[model samples]
Every structure is written in C-alpha cells, then in structure tokens.
Target: MKVYIETYGCALNKGDSYIMMTLLKESGHEIVENYSQADAIILNTCAVRLETEERMKQRIKELRKIGKKLVIAGCLVSSEPALVMNLAPESSLVGAQSVDKIVEAVESPTRRIFLEDSKELITPRVFEGKISIIPIADGCAGDCNFCITKLARKKLRSYPPRSIVNAVKEAITNGAVEIELTAQDTAAYGLDINYSLPELIKDVLEIEGNYMIRIGMMTPELAMKEIDDIIEIMKDRRVYKFLHLPVQSGDDRVLKLMNRKYTVDEYKQLIKEIRNKIPLVNITTDIIIGHPGEDEEAFNNTLGLIKELKFERIHLAMYSIRPNTKSALMPQVPDPVKKERMRIANKVYEDVAYSVHSEYIGSNSLVITTEYGKKGSIIGRTINYIPVIVKDYNKLGDWINVKITEASFFDLRGQLIQ
Candidate 1:
C-alpha cells in the first residue's frame, strides 16, 4: 500500500508524521510524496487555535473533493473526533496518542477509530532530513483554561531517561545533526516517576551523539523550580542554549482567570534570573492575546513586558476558545477585539524583533545550515535559534561561521566568515 501524510500544527505533529511514515515502511507499505498517487491520504491535523482548526476543516473539504480514502489523525481527531466524522464521514479518525497505530488505520477498513492513550514505544523520528525530534514524554497536566489540547492529551508520562538516550543515539547514528526533545511540557518530564529534566538531559548527553539536542518549550512554573539544576545540566555540549517558555499573559487578574499558576511578576523574575546568569541566552516565548477576560490594561501589560524582554522569537497567537475548556464559557471575547489585540501584539513583536536582531549585524554565529536561500544565500540558525542567511554554502548541515553583514527582524543576512 502507498500512503501520503499531511501534517499540521507544531513540530510534534511533524514528528508524528515522520514516525508514521517510518512505521508504515517497516509494516510493508510505501510512503508516497503526493496524495494523488497514494492508496490513502492521512492528514496529521492540528487544532491549536480556532483559526488553525478552521484551516484544517477547509483543507479537509478541499481534499475530500479530490483526495480519496482520507484519514484524519492528530490532535483534531482526538479532541473532536465526532466533528471530524461529521465533516469527513468516510474518514478514519486517530489522535496524537494513536500516532503509533497509523499503519493499522491505513490498512484496516475502519470508519472511525481512536488509539490515543499512553505513550512510550521508543519511536525515534527525524523530520525533513534535517533534525531528529524525539518525544521523550507526552500529555500535559497543566489545566490552562484556554487549552483544549490538554484535555485531548491523556496524562504526563515521561519515558525513562535511558529510553530517550537510546533514541538520541540512534538518531545521531542516522546522520541527524539535531536531536529535538519535545512534549506538551518538557519541564513536566519525569515528574510522574520523580525524575527531572536535568536528569534526562544528562542521560541523553552521555549517549555520544554528535548532534545537538534542542529542548522543547517548557512552562516557567515548572522550569523555575529547578532553574539552577536545569542550567547546569543544559550546559552539555549536545544541548542548545535556547529555552522557550510560554507566558500566556502578563497580568495577574488575567493570569488567575486563565488558571495560570504563576503571576506575570513571577514569570518575569524567572526570566530575569535565567538571563542574568546566562548572558546571551536566546529566550523565546508564546503570547496568547484575547484570552478570555483579557482587558485593554492586561493587553498593554503584556505589550510592556514584550518590550522589556525583547524575545529572540515570539509566537503570538490570537485567543481561540476551544470547546469544553473553562475559558470558552466565560464572556466570549469579541472577534474584532481579538483581531485588534493580535495586531497590537504582532506590531510590538515586529519592532523588538528587528531591533534586537540588528545587534548581531557584525557578530559571528554558528549556524546549522538547513536550506539554500535565493541568489547565493544559504540559510540556517544560530545556537541561540535566530535564523541567519548565509550567501554561500561553505557547507550546509555542518556548522559554519557566519559574519553578519545585514539583519532583518525575522532573519539575518551574513557572509561566510571563511
């Protein structure tokens, strides 16, 4: 059988698609490049936000017109399986938890099936031939009022430190330059078994991987608990110096309403401590504007903090109320208000992004070459996770020194220092 996979949502989703492809191949199936040529079409859907879900719906509708024997498998199928069935009646449904069962779905004649529970099968996957993204854990216990994903994901369960180490070992052996450790919350890793992120990293680093490990996004609440320990552990040569902490809001009232345990002030203190100790560390965060009950003052407070922090990257998303989440029932934020607030957040981010990026104009950075840019430019990212576009491939994939000649808010243009 030939199968085609379409992935949406975060890096995790992409990782799942890769795993599915690899598993299918191992299970006597061929993975096709195009849906038109495949025996089946599988959409690894994402429902992170209302807009993303709508886009998935739109894609499903369009694909159903031409894509035959469709399979809807991802967070969307997990969270709203019935809705997916309603839309694509003939489609098979699978959830994020059911990622390992993609081959069965493709071969079976089932109309709708759910296989989303418990994770830890040692599924090591590499995405886009560039990096390895391994799921060291899955599910998040954090019950943020605005999150629907939390509901869909089962529980926080971290794989044994040795398991992750083995996966990274295999990935490195496969010529992966990067090993990305991901989950709903990397900070919550091992809490179920009384282990911690630091312990996990130490184990993985000992696996003798030439590739670098990029720790996925972590909440400040969990990360701040053992900041010292985390810093010490992450200093390993294999670990990248990038930390992504999501701060949904910068206002206490809004934070409380959103069920976020930490106040804006507490999050800021964590940020300050981390940056104070690790100067030049790349700090990135997620900001969700228009979360229920977010007022103008709250929004501005967020804006103020963004200005102060000057994040290397800001993943700003307009609040999208998911069904069954606590915030969705609270006074509905007007769509127009959400749009305006998103604009404000984006604008603030734009200015800081370009301005902060400009400082590297004359500095040299170690970039992992990913793609070639137009007109003699090759693109990669710094150890700090900032995108740098180099004019030539002194080499791609291998780390190379780039002296920044010009910088933009979103990317940097550099010349090969060699």
Candidate 2:
C-alpha cells in the first residue's frame, strides 16, 4: 500500500508520525511523498487550541473529497471523535496512544479506534534531513484551566530512560545531527516513573555522537522545581543553548485565572537564573493576548513584560475558547477586543524581537545546516538556536562558519565564510 502521512501540532506529534511511517514501511507498505499518489492518507492532528482543531477538521474534509481512504490520528481522536466520525464516517480513527496499530487501521476493512493508554516506547523512526524528533514522554502533569490538551493527553507518563537512550543512540547512528527531546512538559518527565530529565540527558550524552540535543517546551512551574539540575545538564556542550518556557501571561491575576501555578515574578527569576548561568542562551516564550479576565491592565502588563524580557522569539496567540475547559465558562473576552489586543501585542513583540536580534547583525558563528529556506536559500541554526539563512548550497548536517550580514525580526541572513 502507498501511504501518505501528514502531521500537525508540536514536535511530539511529528515524532509520532515518524514512528508510524517507520512502522508502515516495516510492514511492507510504501510511504508516498505526495498525498495524491497515496493509496491511503493518515492525518496526525492536534487539538491544543480551537483554531487548530477547526483547521484540522477542514483539512480532513478537503482530503475526503479525493476519494482515497483516510485515517485520523493524534489528539483529535480523543478530543472530538464524534465530530471526526461525522466528517469522515468511512475514515479509520487511531488515537494518539494507539499509533502502534496504524497498520491494522489502514489495512482492516472495519473502522479501528484505539484510545487505550499505551505505554510502549522505543519505536523505530525514519529520521529526515539532519534533525530527528524524539518524544521522551507523553501527556503532562499540568491541569491548566484553558487547556484541552490535558483532556486529550491525561497524566504524566515518561518513557523509560533505557528506551529513550536507545532511541537517541539509534538516531545519532543513523546520521541525525540534531535530536529534539519533546513532550507536553519536558521538565515534568519522570514524575510517574521516578526518572529525571537531567538523568535522561546524561544517558543520551554518554552515547558517542557529534550531534546536539534541543530540549522542548516545559512550563515555568515544573522547570522551577528542577532548576538546579536542569541548569547543570544544560551546561553540556552537546545540548543547545536554547530554552522555550512559555510565560502565557505577565499579570499574576490573569495567571491565576489561567490556573498557572507560578507567578510572573517567579518566571522572571527563572529566566534570570538561566541567563546568569548560561549567559549566551536564547530564551523563547509564548504569550496569549486576550485570555479570560485579561482586561486592559492585564494586556498592558503582558506588553510590558515582553518589552522587559526581550524574548528571542514570542509565540503570540489570542485565547481560543475550547469546549469542556474551565475558562470557557467564564465571561469571554470580546472577539474585537481580542483582535485589538493581539495587534498591539504583535507590534510590541516585533519591536522587542528585532531589537534583540539586531545585536547579531555582524557576528560570526558556526551553524549546522538544518533545512531549505526561500528562493533556494538554506537555513541553519547557531549554538543558541538563532536561525541563519545562507544562499550557498551546503550539505545537510555539515557545520559551517558564516558571518551574519543581515537580521530580521526572527532570523538572520548569513554568508558562508569561505
């Protein structure tokens, strides 16, 4: 069978798709590069926000018109199985936890829905390009008021250290130059299994490899609990000097309303500590513009915080009311108001981000080519994870020195120093 797999959402979802593709290939199915050529299409989806969920639904509708068999996987299966069945009644439904049964779902004439808790890990993945995404854990320990992901991915279930270590070793052995350790909350890993993220990193680093490991997003509260150990592990040269900790809001009141456990002050202090120890680290965060109870003052507070922190990257999004979440029951922010606040927040973020990136306009650094960019250009990342685009053709996974010639709000343009 010729299969086409499309993935959405976080790195974890992408990793799951990789595993599914590897499994399908091992089962004697050919993986097709084009959706039109596939005998069946598998959409690995996301439902973190209402917008994403709707987008995924629309995409399924689009794919259904092609007359090919469809398979639905990922969070959407657990979050809105009924709606999925309504949209594509003939499609096979394989939930996020049941990815191992993808072959059965595709081959079986009857519909298959696998929503049971799956503890299996260490699945083989087809590494693409120079990067390989490895999921260290699934789900998370948080119960944020507005999060539908908590319902989709329940509880913290960390993969065994031995399994994760073997996966990492396999990736590096297969010429993977960048390994991304992803989860819903990477710092909360091992809470259910008595393992720590630092310990996992130590085990991965012990493998003989010339690659760098990039840590995924972790909530500020959980990150704070393991700060000392995390910082120590980050000092290793094998790890990227980058941190992604979403602050969400800058006002304590808004944070409390969002059910965030940590205060804005605590978030700031964590950033301070990381910068003090790893002075050249790049810090990125997420900010929601109009969450419930975020009045003008709260919005302004978020703007103020972004200006002060000067985040290397800001994932600014408007609050989306998701079904079955606590925040949906509160007095919702007006859509117009959310749009206005989002505009102002976006301007603030661009200004602050451009200012931070401006400092790299004339620096020289060693970057590993990761992906292709626009107009035949190539994209690479510095040690701090700042994206650099060069026009010269370079082999993937090769380290090359480049001089920063220009800067954008989010990335840099570089010329290879020949």
Candidate 3:
C-alpha cells in the first residue's frame, strides 16, 4: 500500500509521524510524497488552540473528499475524538500515545480507533535531512489554565533512559548531525521514571558522534529545579547553546491566572542565572497577548519584560480559547484590544530581535551547515544556534568559518571564509 502522511504541531508530533512512517514501511507499505499517489492518507493533527483546531477540521474535510482510507492521528484524535468522528465518521482514529498502532489503523478494513498507550519508544530509520527529532517523553507535568495540550497528553510518560540512549545512538549512526530532544516539557522528563534529563543528556553525550544536540522547550518551573545541572551539561561543545524557556505572561497577576506556577521575579532571576553562566546562550521564549484577565497594565508589563530581556526569538500569539480549558470560562479580551496589543507586541519584538541579531555583524564565527536555504543558499547555525545563510556552500553537515556580513530580524547572512 502507498501511504501518504502529513504532520502538524510540535517537534513531538513530527517525531511521531516519523515513527508511523517507519512502521508502515517495515510492514511492506510504501510511503508516498503526495496524497494523490496514496491508497491511504494520515493527517497528524494538532489542536493546541481553537484556531489550530478549526484548521485541522478544515484539512480533514478536504482530505476526506479524496476518498482514500483516511486516518486521523495525534492530539485531535485523543482530545477531540468526537469532533473528528463528526467531521469524518468513516475515518480511522489513532491517538497521540498510540502511534505504534499506526499500521493497524491504516490497514484495518472497517472504521477503527486505536487509543491504547504503548510503553515502547520506536526509533525512526528515516529522518528529515541530516536532522533527527527524538522524543524523550510524552505529556507533561504542568496544569497551566490556558493549555489544551494537557487534555490531549494527560500524563507524564518518560521513555526509559536506555531506550532514549539507543534512539540517540540510532540517530547518530543514521548520519544525523542535529539531534533534537523533544517533549511537551523536556524538563519534566524522567520525573515519572526516576531518571533525570541531565542524566539522559550525559548518556547521549557519551555516544561517539560529531552531531549537535538541541534541547526543546521546557517549563520554567521544572527547569528551575535542575538549572545548574542543565547548564553544566550544556557547557559541552557538542550541545547547542540555546534554551527555550517560555514566559507566557510577564505580569504576576496574569501568571497566577494562567497557573504558570512561577512568579515574574523568579523567572527574571532564572534568566539572570542562565546568562551569567552561559553569556552566549540564545534564549527564545513564547508570549501570549491578551489572555484572559490581561489588562492594559498587564500587557505593558509583558512589553516591558520583552524589551528588558531582548529575546533572540519571540513566538507571539493572541489568546485563542480552547474547549474544556479553565481560561475559556473567563471573560475574553475584546478582539480589537487583542489585535492592537498583538500589533504593539509584534513591533516591540521585531525591534528587539533585530537589535540583538545586529550585534553579530562584522563578527567571525564557526557554523555547521544544517540545511539549504532559498535561492541556492546554504543555511548553517553558530554554536549558539544563530542561523547563518551563505550562498557559496552546498555541503550539508560540514563545519565552515563564516564572516557575518548582514543581519535581519530573523536570520544572518554571511560570506564563507576562505
């Protein structure tokens, strides 16, 4: 059978899609690039917000028209299975934790649903280019009021350290130069299994490879517990000097309303500690504008925080109510107010990001080519994960010295150093 799979959402979802594809291929099915060439189609969906959920619904409707055996996979199948059923009653359903059962879901003749949890972690033989995404765990330990992902992945299930180590080894052996350790909350890994993330990193570092390991998003509260250990592990040259610690809101009141567990002061102090230890660490964060109970003062506080931190990257979003979330019951900010706040926040982020990236101008740095960029350019990343684009280089995993020639808010353009 020819199967076509489309994935959405976070790195974890992408990792799951890889697993499904590998499993299907092992079961004598060919993975096709286009939906038109497949006998079966799998749509790995994400529903973190209402807008995303609606998009998934519309996509499902379109794929259903193709009349192939459609299988709805990932978060939507777990969190909103009924809605998926309503949209396409004949489609098979496979939940986020049930990816190991993808072959069953795809091959079953009648309508079927596979929501059972699997304890084993399956490593993908195929990867995206030279980068491999390895999921260390599923679910998280947070109870944030605005998070609908908690409903989809309700429990923290950390894969065994041995399993994860093997996955890393497999990825490296398969010629992956960039290994991304992903989860709903990477710092929450191993709380359920008595293993620690630092320990896992140490184990992975022991693997004989030339690849760089990039850790994924982590909840600040959990990260605070092992910040020092994490920093120590990151000091290794093989690990990317990047951290994604999301400070969703900057006001203490808003933080409390969102049940983020940590205070604004605490978050500030954490950032201070991290920067003090790793000055070149690239800190990226997420900010949600106009969440429930965010007044003008709260929004200003967020803006102030953004300016103060000067994040390397900011993933800004307007609050979108999700069903069954606590925040959805609260009064929403007016659409106009939300839009205006988002506009202001976006401008602030752009200015800060451009200023931050501009500092690299005229600097010489070592970067590893990771992927090809647009118009015959090769994209690479510095030790701190700053993206650099060079027009002359085509080697995909080779390290090259680059002179930073130009900067944009999003990336840096460089010239190869002879």
Candidate 4:
C-alpha cells in the first residue's frame, strides 16, 4: 500500500504522522510524497479552533475528489467523529491515542474507529527535516473552559520516561540537531506518573549527542509548580533558552470565567524569575482575543500586558466557538470586535518584537543550519532559537558563526562572519 500522510496543528500532530509513516514503512508499505500517487490518505487533524476544523473539512472534500481511501486521525477523531464521517463517509478514524493501530486501519476492510485510552507508544519515527518533534505525552492536566481539546484528550497520561529518552537518543543518532519536547501542556508532564520533565531531560542529555531540546508551551499554573527545577534544568548548555508560556488573558474576571487557575500577577512573576536567571531567554506567548466576556476593559488589560511583557513572539488567535465547549455556549464577542482586537494586538506585537529583535543586529553568534529559506536563502537558529536567514545553500546540520545584519518583527538576517 502507498500512504501519504498530511498533518495539521501542533508538533504532536507532526510527530504522530511521522510515527504512522514509520509504522507503514516497517510493514512493507510505501510512503508517497504526493497524495495523487498514493492508495490511501491519512489526515492527522487538529480541532483546537473552529476555523482549523473548517479548513480540515475543505481539505477532506478536496482529497475525496482524488478518489483514494481516507483515514482521519488526531483530536477530531475523539471530539467529533461524526464530523469526519459526515465529511468523508467512507473514511476510517483513528484518534491520537490510537496511533499504534494505524497499520491495522490501513489493512482492515471495515471502517475502523479507535478512541480508547490505551497506553501511549513511542514508535520509531522518520523525521523529514533537521529537527525532530518528540511528543513527551498525550493530553494535559488543564480543563480550560474554552478548550474542546480537553474532551478529546481526556486525562493527562505521561509516556514512560525511558521510551521518551530512547526516542530522543534515536533521533540524535539519525542526525536530528534539534529535538522538540511537545505536548498539550509540557509543564504538566509526569503528573500522572511519579516522574518529572527535568528528570527526563537529564536522562536524554546523558546520551552522547550534539543537539538542543525545545520545550513546548506550558500553562502558567503548572509552570509555577516545578518552575525552580525547570529553570535549573534549562540552564544546561544543550537546552535552548526559550519559553512558550501562554497568558490567555490579563483580566482576572475574564480569566476566572475561562477557568484559568493562575492570576496575571503570578504569570508575570514567573516570567520575571525566568528572565532574571536566564538573561537572554527568548520568551514567547499566546493570546486569544474577544473570548467570552472580554469587553473593552478586558481587551485593554490584554494590550497592557503585551506592552508590559514585550514578548519575543506572540501567537494571537481570534476566539471561535466550537461544537461543544463551555465558552461556545457563552455569549460571544461580536466578529467586528474580535477583528478589531486582533488588529490592535498585531500592531502592539510588531512594535515589541521589532524593538527586541533590533538589539540582535551587529551581534555575532553561532547558528545551526536547520531548514531552507525563501528565495535561495537558508535559515538557521541562534542558541536562543532566534531564526537567522543567510543567503547560502548550507548543509542541513552544518553550523556557522554569522554576524547579524538585519532585524524584523518575524526574524533576523545575517551574513557569514568568515
């Protein structure tokens, strides 16, 4: 069988697709690059937002026209299996937790659906680029009112630390220079088991390899729980000094409504502590605009927080009502208001990012070539994970010292400092 897997959403989805491809190949099936050249298509989907779900629906329609067998995987399989079936009636559904059964789904004659909470497996994966995305766990501890994902990924269950360590070891051996420890909330890792993320990192780092690990997004409440230990572990030279901590809102009233356990002050203090210890750490964050009960004052509070924090990167999202979530039932902010808030957030982020990134200009740093850039250039990353685009065709895993020549809100451009 020839299988072409298309992935959507976060790093976890990408990691799942890689595992599925590896499984298929190990079973003597071909993994085709183009969907038109394949006998089956697997869409590892994400329904974190309603907009993303709509896009997935359209893609299913397009793929259905290709006349190949379809397999739907990811959060949609558990949250709304009917959506997948309605979009492509003949499609088989495999939830994120059922990734290990992908081979059976492909070979079985019946329409397969697996959504049980089975033991998480870390199968051998074949990564496409220089970076490898390794999922530390499936699901999370948070029950945010606005999240439909919580329904799909029910309980927080950490994968065995040994399995994760082995996955990282194999990735490093396979020429992966960057490893991403991804999950719904990395801060909540190892809660179910009597283990911790720091312990897992220490074990993985013990492996003899030249690579860096990028920790995924963490909720503020859980971050504070093990923050001291996490900061100590991050001080290791092999870990990138980057933190993605999403502060959904700055207003206490709105946050309470959203079921976020932490206050704005606590989030600010965590940022302060981390920055004080790691002076050059790159702090990124996520913000959702016009969520339920976010009136003019609440939106102002968010803008104020963005100005105060001056995040290195901001993933701004407009609130969208999904099929079944607490926020979806609540009164929604008008579409026009959402659009306006997004504009303000974008402008504020642009100013902050430009100011912060401009300081990197004229600085010289060592960068690892990770991926290709637009228009005959190559993209690399500094120790802090800041992307530096240089005009060259460097090998994927090559490292070079470059002097920063340009800066922008999105990335930095540099010249090889030979």
TM-score of each: 0.95, 0.98, 0.99, 0.98
Candidate 2, superposed: residue stretches over 4 Å from native? none
Q: Write the residue-wise lDDT of candidate 1 on 1-418 in tens digits.
A: 9888888888777767877877888888888889888889999888888889999999999889985788888888888887888899987777888777777788887675866573445465445565778887778868888888887676777778877777777777778787788888999998998898888887777776457778898988999898999888667666677999998787889989988889888898998988887776789999888888888898899999999988988988888889888998999779999898898789899999999999988888777886667887777878767778776674557888889899777888888877
Clashing pairs in 4: none
**Residue ranges of candidate 4 with Cα displaced over 4 Å:** none
Which tens-of-lDDT digit does each residue in 1-418 have in candidate 4?
9999999998878888988988899999999999989989898999989889889889889988887788888888879988788888888889878888898888888788877866547645788788999888888998899998888888887888888888888888899999999989988889889888888888888988789889998998988988898899889888999999999998999999899999999999999999999998999999999999999999999999999998999999999997888898999899998998899889999999999999999989899899988888999998889999999546778889899999999999999977
Reference-based lDDT, residue 129, model 4: 80
Task: Output the TM-score of candidate 4.
Answer: 0.98
User: How high is the CA lDDT of each candidate model?
Assistant: 0.82, 0.89, 0.93, 0.88
For residues 1-418, could you state the per-residue lDDT of candidate 2 as single tens digits? 9999999998989989988988899999999999989999999999988889989989999999998888999998877788899999988998877788889899987777778766466455677888989888888998899888888887677888888888888888889989999999999999998888988898888998789999999999999998998889889888999999999999999999999999999999999999999998999999988999999999889988999888999998899998889999999999999999999889888888899889998889899898888899999999999999999865788889999999989899999999
* Model 1 local distance difference test score: 0.82
TM-score of 2: 0.98
lDDT of 3 by residue, 1-418 (tens): 9999999999999999989988999999999999999999999999987788989999999999999999999998898889999999999999998888899889999999987787676766668788999889999999999998888888889988887888889878878899999999999999998988999999999999799999999999999999999999999999999999999999999999999999999999999999999999999999999999999999999999999988999999999998899999999999999999999999999999999999999999999998989999999999999899999889999899999999988999999999
Predict model 3's lDDT versus the native.
Answer: 0.93
Tell me how far the alpha carbon of residue 25 in candidate 1 is from the true structure, in angstroms, after superposition: 1.3
C-alpha RMSD values across all candidates? 1.7, 1.1, 0.9, 1.1
Model 3, which residues run further than 4 Å from truth?
none
List pairs with backbone clashes in candidate 2.
none
